[model samples]
Target: MGLKAFIGKLYAGIAQKQIENMRKNGIGLQNKTFQYLVNEATATVFGIDHGFANIKTYEDFKARVPIRDYEELRPYIDRIMRGDDDVLWPGQPAYLAKTSGTTSGVKYIPISKQSMPEHITAARNALLNYAYETGNTSALDGKMIFLQGSPEMHEVSNIPVGRLSGIVAHHVPIYLQGNRMPTYKTNCIEDWEEKVEAIVDETIKQDMRLISGIPPWCQMYFDRLSAKTGGKKIKDIFPNFKLFVYGGVNYEPYRARIEESIGFAIDTIETYPASEGFIAFQNSQKDKSLLLLVDAGMFYEFIPAEEFFNDKPTRISLKDVELNKNYALILNTSAGLWGYNLGDTIKFVSKNPYKILVTGRIKHYISAFGEHVIGEEVEHALMKIAAEEGLDVVEFTVAPQVNAPAGQLPYHEWFIEFGKAPADLKAFSQKVDKVLQIKNIYYADLIEGNILQPLIVKVLKKNAFVDYMRAEGKLGGQNKVPRLSNDRKIADQLTEYILN
Candidate 1:
């Protein structure tokens, strides 16, 4: 066998062992995992203060610790930043994964030394499981390129800070360094445009067998590659490319553009990693859902999305979650976050092996008129419309047009920047409205009751969304266009940028 094939077989074996262990334990292992976390964390300040030593059951643990978001944990993180050990976990985190915030400027999530191995292992298993399940391991033959944030780490109160992607890149196995592209020097360039140019120069001619990145940025890279090489598609440049691993945002809308650029069908794997920790990843080529990383150094809980904003919410363990219900994910990780709300919504597609689909962000939606619409629903509707109309959507956002001058009703406004505009723009807008109406009963009722006008569609000037993100300081690397907003905050901003 070739070296790549040998490596693929090795990875398959490792992933199989992990999968078998989970299958052997089943739901019973969740309780054991929770117990193990509690025991390991009992010595920390959070654990002691939360009465972790006395907790014996999931119910007991839930009753002691309340569900919290980053704001609630900021004080503890601040203490950790000041060089305090055992504030949240056993010792200080190896680094803080700095993430862009919606309203807040930034968020610093701790990445503990105790938890780094778990993070690394979860990533490895994702690739290996895909190889084993599909028997398509040629991806291991050549270099795998990842488009990530700059690796230049900054310091916050004497603690290192950088993007999660950069932190993970630092931990890439030594054996695989020869097979990963874009040298560390190139990865450290702070300017995104410069870095993209550098990456194109560094890997354009390499045997790039695998490519992984968020879909929108990946689209940007493909565009640059095609432009520089004078190629019709990415396949013309890198014929050996086999897999496209993506996450952080919905890929449905970008799928057509990416495939067209590739000039052929290639396998795709979706992952659900966040600043808090890696959560889940695609484990089978046949399945659309992701298997939860149950064995990783994290304990999971779910709060029904409906009750999430209530005065008091219900938290359900993995065994209690029902299929098809939207739930806000809660995590108590080895990295020291406990009962933390990651703010993303998810729905389970399978319960046997516990596979889930990310629905949307809990804070991202349009609910100004009691006609609630989440990101997932919006993306799905747009994807359907684009497919039928042969359009290529580059980026888009939706907001409630709440303030009408006079003699008009409120409605939802869609701002879209298309790579390929439709032949009949009016018909495309009508189809988009129709699909959304079918998907959301609340929205349909609002239209039926004459409480909302037919949705307004605004075909944005080219690069409008990109310009907006650039002005907002969130131009690249896991930052995404806010899919749905309750108010016209983002829509107004995009309007201003387009005018400029």
Candidate 2:
């Protein structure tokens, strides 16, 4: 191994030991984290207002603070933006992670000095754990590319503000700076297509062994590279390419096309990260679920997903979670967010070490007919059929079609973009519908009761989703198309791209 690889291996060893300790003491560490956050923020305006000083246990904390989304917390966030010190967190925030919100338009999530390092550490340890488990650190010696938002930032009350991925770009460890690709100038381009073109120009000939990005954007990069190289596979361009690290969405739907572009299969690590906090990461290659980051300066809570919208939902801690049940994730972070609803749903796959699978978004689902189909269930059903039929799905979405033509029953409409269309499209649709029914019993009952028809598959012309996102001005950088929607807002717009 090279000097850099050897150093990485040593660091991985130390990180692995720390992770083992965390696994063994998951519940204890979470309790400690909870106490530390509550105690540290006692003097802050939000803390004082919520009676944080009197909170001695989880129940006490819950009673003192009610669950809040970004909109509800905006009043406190406004104070911070207006130059208030010790408002939400201790003193002023080091940075504000700017992100798009569905209902709120834009959100500025604070990243405190004490909390920022946890994000970087959790990301670093994910790779370190991968290296330690696989005994492969050679990727550290090669060029790496992280396709992310522009690192440019404006100031709000003297705090640097930018997208979470862009803010993270500024913190790439000094040691890895030399190995990072696509010069800073290329990364700052505002237009995603133009930025991707510049990236291709800069790194097409370089040795790119580690590539990281959301799966859809990464697929676009692969397509651009192939065009630049006259249809050459990604492995042909970067022969040393080995590890792909990704998050933000499920990768299974895009797996076939990505591997085909790469010319072969490669090791991948999945991470569950967000602007609020780094939540989990895949610790072992053999395990598909991610190990929850219980000790990473954040305390977690969960509400049963079915009861999430109730007037008074049951909120439980890590010790109370059971395997295979979906729950809406909540957190109290060192970043000064208390009783914050993350809006993501997750299911515990392994409780011994507290591993989880991100199931879906709380607001992103289809239940127009009382058949609540989630992102995980749709992805699972689609990918299963795609694998069996040797089909390549580029992108897809599901929405309820409440109104149909005369004498037709209401049904789920699937908008699918295929890299390679199936030989028998009708048969393929039936197979997917059968699988989905098996996965979601509610959908099956709706069909068997004659309340709905088997799903209708609508083929989408190539680049349909890409075009839809572009039209909506959300083409790249952490933005993703929702897998399922209950209404026809998105479905109505998608009609223009449907194949005749």
Candidate 3:
């Protein structure tokens, strides 16, 4: 075997063994991991203050450290940024990953030496797991283009502040860097447009075997490639392109357009990697579920989504999680975040193997007028309808339009940017409304009681969200249009670009 293929097989074997060990040990290993983390962090100020040394049980840890969001953890992160040692982790973080925040603006997430390797390892294992499942070692032979964020790192109190992708890109193994496309200089181009064009120019003639990126950005890359290569599909340009690895957004809506761009079906792997930590990855080619990274240096807890908004919610461990129940994720990582609510929700598909599907973000929902709707419900409805109608939906967002003036009632408004529109717009709106009503009883009750009007659908000009995101300085890399809003904020903004 070639060097790349040999390395691929070796890594795959290692990854598969780790996955199997995780599955077999599962809860016992998780508890031990938690105890280890607690012991390691006991010397830190935050840990010592919380009595981490005396906390031998999960219950004691939970009682000592209350669940918190990024806002609550910001002060400790700020202390770390100011070169404080052992404020949260055992020492100062190596970098501060700047993630987008809602009202708080930029959120600086700490990345210590302990946690950075975990991120890198998780990313590597994702590919290795894919190789193990598919037995396609040839993927490592050709170039793998990771359409990622700008590598321009800014100094935040002597620590780096930049996108997670860029941070990880710098840490890409020297061996794999040989087969990775778009040189570091090209990736450092801060302007996404310039980066995309430069990447196309640099790698158009190379042998590309794998493409890994967020679906929206990947679509843009594929579109540019197709356009540049005389209307040829991605496969036509790079016939050996065998794998598409994606995360950051639901791939369902983008799947039709992605396949069209590729001109054929290909293998895919999904991942649930966040700046907080790399959480899960699709391990089996046969199942669409993702195996939870139980051994990945992070302790996990789940709060039932139904009770998440309550004054006191039940928090359960990985062993206590049930199949097919929506739960908000809470994480305690070696990176110094204790009981940090990642703000994302997920449901377990298989407990034995510990597979999960990301449901939605905690605050990403529309509950205005008591017609509660989550991102997962809206995405599923839209994906199903778009498939049935043979339409290609690129992106979409929903918000409540509460002030209907004097006599009219409030209704949900959907702003969609479609690659291909439905034949009947009115019928499309009706179908979407029906699905939401069926999924959410509160919404159905409102409609039946004549308290709310039927949902409204407005097709926006193509790239409307792209334009909005650009104006907001959030054009690429992990920044996505919020799927649902409680108010008319996003809807009103999109109305400016609506096609009528």
Candidate 4:
């Protein structure tokens, strides 16, 4: 191994010890994190208002702070944006992570100096853990590309503000700077298509071994590269490519098409990161679920997904969580977000090491006919059937077709963009419907009761989803189409791209 690789291995060994300690003492670490955050922010405006000074227990904290989403927390954030001192964190925020919100037009999440290192360290540790377990560090020697938002930042009240990925770009460890690709000039281009074209031109000849990005954007890059090379496989173009790091959305639905683009299967590392904080990462290749970061300067709370909207939903710490039960994730971070409803639902696959799988979004689900189906169920069903039928799906979404033609029953409409169309569309649809039924019993009951018909498959033209996202002004960089929706907002817009 090279000197850099040897150093990386040694660092990985040290990180492994820390990880083992975290696994062994997750509960105690979480409690300490809670106390640290509470004590650190006790003098802040939010903390003072919430009585953090006298709060001595989790229940006290819970009773003092109400769970809030971005809209509800915006008042405190606005104060900080106006240059107020000790409003959220101890002082002013180090940076603001700008992200698109559903109801709120734009959200600016704080990232304190104290909390920012956790994000960087968790991501670094994820990679180091991979090297430690697999004994592979060859990718570090080759060009590594992280397809992300622009690194350019503008300041608000003298505080740097930019996309989470963009902010992270400015902090890339100096050691890896030599290996990172896609010149700063190319990265700074605002238009995604132009940026991608520039990236293709810049990296096509480089020895790319580690590529990281959201799956859809990466797929676009692969497609662009294929077009440029006259249909060359990704592996053929970058023969040394070894690991793909992806987050922001579930990769299962895009797995087949992505592998086909690459010409073979490759190792992958999945991470769970957000504007609020870095939550978890896949520490082991054998375990698909992410290892929750208990010591990452954030305290976690869970509310049963089914009871999330209740006036008094049961909120429990990690110690009280049960296996396989879906919970809406809540966060109280060193960044000074208190009782923040993260809006994502997760299921604990293992409690010993605190491993979790992000099941879906709390607000993103299909229940038009009283059959609530989530993102995981839909993705699981489609991925299962696609594998069995040897089909390759590029992208897909599920929505209720509540208003069917006069004689037709209301049904679930599956808008699918297929890389490889199935031999029998009807059989494919039936198989997916069956699997979905098995996954969500409520849907099965609805179908059995004749309340809803079997799902209808609508094959979309090539690049349909890409076109839709572009039209919606959400082309790339952490933007993704919802997998399931109870209403027809997305379905209505998608009609324009439906195959005739």
Please, what are the lDDT tens digits per residue for candidate 3 over residues 115-151? 8998988888889988887788898888989998877
> Candidate 1 residues 203-227, lDDT tens each?
8989898899999889888888999
Stretches of candidate 4 off by over 4 Å are none
Worst 10 residues of 3 by lDDT: 472-481
- CA displacement after TM-score superposition, residue 176 of candidate 2 (Å): 0.6
User: On lDDT, who's better, 1 or 4?
Assistant: 4
lDDT of each: 0.85, 0.93, 0.88, 0.93
Off by over 4 Å in 1: 155-158, 497-500
- After superposition, the stretches of candidate 2 with alpha carbons farther than 4 Å from their true spots are none
Candidates 1 and 2 compared by lDDT, better number: 2
Query: Which residue pairs in candidate 4 have backbone atoms (N, alpha carbon, C) closer than 3 angstroms, thus clashing?
Result: none
Backbone clashes for every candidate come to: 0, 0, 0, 0
User: Model 2 clash pairs?
Assistant: none
Q: What local lDDT does model 3 show for residue 470?
A: 91
lDDT of 4 by residue, 1-500 (tens): 77777889989999999899989999999999989999999999998999999999998998999999999999999998888889988989999999998668889999999889999999899999999999998888789999999999999898999999999998889999998988899888989999999999999999999999999999999999999999999999999998999999999988888999999999999999999999999998888999999999999999999999899999999999999999999999989899999989999999889999999999999988778899999999999988988888999898999999999899999999998889889999999999999999999999999999999999999999999999999999878898988899999999888998
Q: How many Å off is the CA of 22 in candidate 4?
A: 1.1
How far out, in Å, is residue 167 in model 3? 1.3
TM-score of 1: 0.96
lDDT at 263, model 3 = 87
Q: What is the Å distance of residue 358 in model 2 from its true position?
A: 0.5
